[model samples]
Target chain A: MNFNFINLQPYSNPQYFIYLMIALIPIILGLYFGHRFKTYEAIFSIVFLFLIFDGSHWQQGVNLLIWLVYEFILTFAYQYYRHHGKNKTWVFSLAVILAIIPLAAVKYLTAFPDNSIGFVIGFLGISYVTFKTVQVIMEMRDGAIKKVDPVTYARFLLFFPTISSGPIDRYRRFKKDYEKVPTRDAYITDLQYAVRYLFQGFLYKFVIGWFFGTYWLPKITASALVVGNANGGLKLSWWVLAYMYCYSMYLFFDFAGYSLFAVSISYFMGIHTPMNFNKPFISKNIKDFWNRWHMTLSFWFRDYIYMRFSFFAMKKKLFKNRIRLSQVSYFLLFLIQGFWHGLTWYYIVYGIFHASAICINDMWLRFKGKHKKQIPSNKFTEWFAIFLTFNVVCFSFLIFSGFLSQLWFGWK
Target chain B: MDTKQGVLDILNDLTGEDLSDQMDENIFDNGLMDSMASVQMLLSLQEKFDIDVPVSEFKRAEWDTPNKIVAKVESLENE
Candidate 1:
């Protein structure tokens, strides 16, 4: 099947109102039933709502159906193995492999020049969903949770607000609050907050992000190129670097605004979604930044990938005799975390740079005693760190944007 | 760094208060440790025990009580 971007022209057509109403039917029905029934029934209704939406577009609908099927089959297999007390380690390993398969196929295989099987497999929120599903299954195998009812599973997976972009709620948290859908007053309070957050998100996305993208950034780039003299050179002044930091701040606000909007809306619907950002800019160090920024993704990486790898490395005595286990663990964790974002040389370099910074910071702290005042605690130092961190992060973003090589090598 | 007295040493080193028997997991859980205290504890854990404690693991359940922390440290050391 060929991939076609949704034509929005038809959406603006006057006669499309009937189609819009038809689309709304499922959502209205789902919300009504979600309010009326208990958790399981609510989930089933939500899944039905998603199915209806998926049906609106044929290719997307098929892809969504395939994903649902994959999730169900994996969930059942996990549950069966868990119930029978089978070798859970193998089950978890298999689950991880299965989770990576779709992501790898979509990300890597499709990028091949000669490969003809590049029909778009819908990946809107697949990364987040697949990771969450894998975590849930692994946790279930580890006796961290019991098997969720099919409806609960469906609701957790297809909850509309978070299905697009997520703070990635854990099953335990999802199940607990979902069992007790909030009252009207609570819903009203949540709705107010949700509206406020959505407005803020719009302001960030359209006003701030758009202005910076259209005016501020381009102007800065032009100035830099002219001053630097080399072809495509962007020799930014220190002040421009500071402005870039502000641009980075705006980017975070815009993306995190969307995440907060999703979370707040979900909360009103009686779902306790995770917080994505936590004053990340105030972080004193890269380690602290990781702790506060995109918190759910970091936690997911820590719990599912980092911890498991560290445990395995230690178990195999890989950190024994010569190298410090802590350093090895830190390096491996960061590398894997970087690779999880994408399979690119730049990402690998970005990961290595971050890992190196963290490792050096770790070493410095060790050499200097807790009470040692070698590193300045003043405002200047703090601002300097922030500036450095922002540059590092933005450089990584440049790599992520696939313009690193061009920009670095003086290409237009 | 006596393994038995490690908790008290950590608490004393971190907060500079003689924690005595009053030292418990509640300090970490009840926001008594704060962010700075948590970071300090994390750094200490890494350096002293040669363990890499992911920042994500600094939740209330794992680090709140002295017993739990000791267990975590001991597990890391054994590993």
Candidate 2:
């Protein structure tokens, strides 16, 4: 029940050192026999390490290991069936269903208050990993990729750099670059970038985000905006809103830093990972923002879910009969995407709000074309659109962080 | 309207410009429709026909001509 900062202390017991040692054992062995073993063997070593170091206790380790094994087996089977040019839709779908069960069970069932099942079902990276795994399998089924070697496949799924948090690499794109060896200069450059990213991430997380979360937010919410102050009065509430902006920036930097670190390490190991962040804040519209921000994750959603849903919906007779069917499909895609974030009411609302925004934008553009003279063509109109879009995005983030309750109930 | 004429009507609705009687697939390269306009066209196709037309489907080869889009739409409809 304690949402206090210290209550969420990271698990850093000395016994974790033993888990760390166990994890390193395979990496050592893999290096020793380098070319003698296959990609699967290397991957197994990495996955085993992930499993061993994933938790503090043996049961937790075992649970994580079981999930890893399930993912590996499913990935391998999907690859096998796909290579043989067999109809594996049923099999692939079953795997996706299985992969999502753990996430759904943990998020929905164990998240209840007074539930002792919290320890039994850890959700943290499960949703991310499950989504990535299903996408890899689906991509293979779509013939977007050839059969991935077991080792590379395993590494793709269990790459230590991205396993804990992800930029969610696509199997096909990642595999193409994985096979190429990077030059020494590339490694040096990647390392430099990685270090810079790490520093930025730390600054964002500890100095900026944590500062706002720990100190500034409470003060402003409690006092700053309450009194009817004059025009010259210091409105600390604006300061708090500014910190919210900083927090958003920090979150992106922190995650992107982690991604860069992973990518740099992968580069040293001769893999070229895709860039994740692309000046998302500067995006002129929500749709453009989605395209630029957390790019790999958004693209994963676009390729695997949005496109697939649209493809299937187009085949339906109802879709042929009504334009509403396309709108409904888009709405559903966003809803599922929101649910994928977590089984939270706020996330669902966030998704619906954005989906509706995009839908409205499309409709407006359509209507404006019919009455072209009313449309503005000046820089002011463009800036206004950008300003409105940014506020909409920030408001969406407010809902995402569960701050709407504070606004509505006067509860900080 | 006949099938080809129906396709032409849809294309005219989308581009907001009438196609020449001698319209060729080279219209895309002739700057008749830019990238943003093409995306708009795709969105309209998706909304109107209930087809999931991915941007990938509109590669230079396929989207260069109106005939290609009509053919693609008919095939998708058949599927």
Candidate 3:
């Protein structure tokens, strides 16, 4: 039991992959053959979890263990109730609330850190795990899921590849992939994707993201701040715009790189995890941007939150106008999404900003639809739309980057 | 027209497609339309056919395709 090697953050550096690749070889071979080797897979996952959470991060590891136990009980109990007990909406809602309570509490505690109260049950990947758990409960409510397997639940929850940040695999989809071995031809495709994505991820995260995040972004930020210092204005400058683009690239590269690795590893393990991005900058509108950007999270929000909220509103006839109802739902969805990112003013504003942007986009779309004859749908117009959308999205990323907060408040 | 035709017509309006052959395909899963369009389709269903299906009673898996949407509409209409 020599656990002496330094525990590394998942995909934080190239060195982590050296260990990950070695650990995955057996699993990959097992998948390449007909067998999945479930027990070995589980053991391997646990070993990695222990490593990631054990060293200096051991307390968070212990927290994760406790949290997993709690979720297992909650989901199993809820599954039983759905199967055998009364189908009460309140009970389901209560179960969902309970499922999310720890993550919510942990998020809140981040704001009000107490060195004296050091027993917070928060860890990296808590949010992603909680998302998957809550999804199971929601699906159970819809009767889309009829059976509950505790072992599979545990595996899906702690699946290491997408544990930290996810392409957010659905339980049923994940189980199907886990249970069934892919055909050799199909697996060859997965392997191709896995290798390509891994290399691309290295370039994106290690090279491009590192260069932008570490070098270009900070340099631009310093220059932008100096500009603000000279003028004492709202930190508005060309350099600020340059910083926005730089920060946006850093963010896209880093997160996309991480997601590619996660998806690639899942593919290697024969799990076909869904993609998280789709050429987002080419989007012609804000709504289109959402469909392309962080696709899994946005789609999850669409399916679970926005869709449900819209349905509820339409059911109640909350607004006389259907458009107004959708507008409100978009606002609520994005605001909650923003809050999910953080409880900070900038995050909230970022959410509101997107909500407003999408609403405006929808309105303009309606106007365009009405005046289709008048409005030219030429190549130039399409290019203009893409260019405009790219800038708008980059600006939103600026808000998301939290530079404005430092610029406004830190200066004051 | 039958309930299925009525439902397909609503689906056509929702996605701006002439979906005559794609009734069997799951609209939501196939990306013909989305849940927001589901809301619009529901309103249209209520307005035209006077069938008030509760949102809570509907799941995308159950009522996403035009055929299933029609089945659901007819069932609720009979109810």
lDDT of 2 at A238: 60
lDDT of 1: 0.63
For model 2, how does the per-residue alpha-carbon lDDT over A34-142 read when each residue is reduced to its tens digit? Answer: 4223354465445444443544434444666677787787778777777777855577688678767777776676446655554556534566678777777676665
Q: How accurate locally is residue A244 in candidate 3, as Cα lDDT from 0 to 100?
A: 91
lDDT of 3: 0.85
Clashing pairs in 1: B25-B64, B25-B65
Clashes of 2: 2
For candidate 1, the per-residue lDDT at A348 reads 76
Candidate 3 per-residue C-alpha lDDT over A17-90 given as tens digits, one digit per residue, 9 for 90 to 100: 88889989988888778778889888888888877887678878879989999999999899889888467889
Tens-digit per-residue lDDT, A169-244, candidate 1: 8877788877765666665565677657656756766577667665676675555445544443464455345345
DockQ of every candidate: 0.12, 0.10, 0.30
Ranking of predictions according to DockQ = 3, 1, 2
- Highest-scoring model, DockQ: 3
Per-chain TM-score of candidate 1, chain B: 0.76
Give interface RMSD for all predictions. Answer: 7.8, 5.9, 3.9
Deviation in Å, model 3, residue A375 alpha carbon: 0.8
TM-score of 2: 0.71
